[model samples]
Target: MKKLVSLLWAVTLLAALALSACSSNQATEALTGGDENLSLDKEFGGFGGGDESPGFGDPELMNDSPEDAQVSDVIADEPAVIDAMSSDSPVKAFFLRITWGLLEGDSSATEVIDWSGSAEVSRGTLLVLRTIRFEGNDFVHLPRDSRQKVEFTSQTKRHFDGLLLAIIDNDTTASDTDATDGTFTFVAGSFSKVLNFSELDSLDLLEPVGDMGNEVSIVTRAKDIVPFAGGFFAGRWVKTRRDGGEFKGRWINSLGTNTGFLRGIWGINRFGNKVFKGKYISANGEFRGLLAGQWTFTRGDRAGVFEGRWVNRQHKTVGRLKGHFRTGRAGDRRGHFEGRYRVTHRENAEGSDS
Candidate 1:
């Protein structure tokens, strides 16, 4: 890590501005005090010049008066780090593995999305991307519902200035075969909620990422993404039975990353994500019809999991569910989940159809 920082400092000094970031504070718990967290703010006072960069810290770090800056100053000085990512030459890249969860209009309905790309950050502008390999309009793991509607081919013009005003075509265009727009909100693991044009445009830009790595990710504001986020994911489910039969399913409302209602499952309880309250209808085919119960599945980006059991509307346990969950931020339930479970039917099962 020290070697990387030295290399970065060496390279940065030559490019435009000379940066002198103080050595990162090593973790107090470690014997060597190696900086496990690598908290940058305390390291360099927000990446500004420190005592190391000659003629750089005159005004800020050294607390030199105006006269000193004038005497030693040769030309106008640039910031220590401008757009830490997304530069024309070599911008920083944060390798994030985001497993997007959901995309409902709600702020909590974030889906599990794996992020594996870089955010080319520069001074004030931030550009993030995850290469989505195209396979007949579908990218890896990005369920059909999560794909954006806009397209970005060579012809499509993607736009971004600084804040979340970036643009994708809004309509599906001749887009690049693969792409994933970063809408980084909250912090590292916890991504922003699913948003649309209106929802996103109204939002403020999220804070920049701290450390850049596999654990890092960013979500683009819904408005900025509309122009180039590209592609579309319609919601539909197909369950293949052990026998030669399959029942098609779809959500009454789009189930996003966090919480949303599910519908049309031949056998199951209510919308079992977070709220875990919805109805289960019985289909006539190979699918056995079942009555409604209390069931929900809430996913967290980094830590929470709404698992355990299926319950009735009265909150009585009817069945059990087991799933794995991860954290997004400090708060539990702010992350996402994936799991499997079964529901128990009452002796006198009353069924209905919607």
Candidate 2:
């Protein structure tokens, strides 16, 4: 009886060990088989999984025991099936590769083409191109005639399907069957932003890109010049001093010679361009209308012509006087003053008196 009990216990122990070994092998097979599909999900989303589970009776991947885990038939050094790959859905590295031309073998070769400048698009429509390329390596710059064709063709490409603006080759013409030969270049992996007509006009980006194309061109729209200085004519012969106290006086016709005295304030304009527009007070306390004139200055001497209609206290054109004035006289107070007299008054000078 003691021998029979011991043999039975030994037999039970052997059976338990065999079952445990089978369970362990099954777990190992399950773990390894599921791993390959999981890896595909992380990398390429399982292109060839074909809805089959591991350790199934597919016959090709079936195992004799659970210990025989599923193994990938893929070669370790096989090139990626790019056609089957989702390259169109761009990745960070993909854009980096395209713009920067980083070569892995030959596709990413960095061949620099001449910078053709920039383009603009808006609301999915091509607007204008601001830059023109001169020369490029491994690429032909877009001919002026082919700009429109190239722009239209590029807008349809996979790389620029949704892009608003881009810089591309000029080979796409009506004559060329396959004109998309140039690579789109990018700076820091982004195409330039599109500019509107108003924005472009306001910013003044359109300019003669001087002899050197590398420099930035700035455009400025000009404004109309409104008269800032105009008033009562108080002075005909006015003197301006840099120190202070602007003189305002007028010239009056006298006996024998056209003797006239004047007084008015003289100063430069906002642009520092000389100007003298002020009220002219005659020696007889008669306030003439307004005198407006400009001073064209040179080295040590300055001269200009004064133009204005002289009016008396009754607001009448007593006598018109044309002043061909000059500052810094060589001697006397004579300059050049000539004009027609009023119908009532008569005062005429032969030539000049200094």
Name the top lDDT candidate: 2
Per-residue C-alpha lDDT of model 1 across residues 1-354, encoded as one tens digit per residue: 999999998887865442222211211112112423312112111111111222222232122111100111111122422222212313222222222223111244333233222222111222213222212322222121222221121100111111111222222332456254433222213333343333332222222222221121122222211111111111212212210001112111000111111221211212222222122222221112222222222322222223333334344444443333322322121222233333343432232222
lDDT, candidate 2, 76-154, per-residue tens: 1124322111223221001000111110012222333232233322211121212111111212223323322222122
* Candidate 1 lDDT trough over 10 residues, lowest sum: 154-163
Q: What is each predicted model's overall lDDT from 0 to 1?
A: 0.24, 0.26
lDDT of 1 at 234: 15
Q: Which stretches of candidate 2 lie over 4 Å from their true place?
A: 1-250, 254-261, 271-273, 280-283, 298-300, 310-321, 328-354
Return the TM-score for each candidate structure: 0.20, 0.21
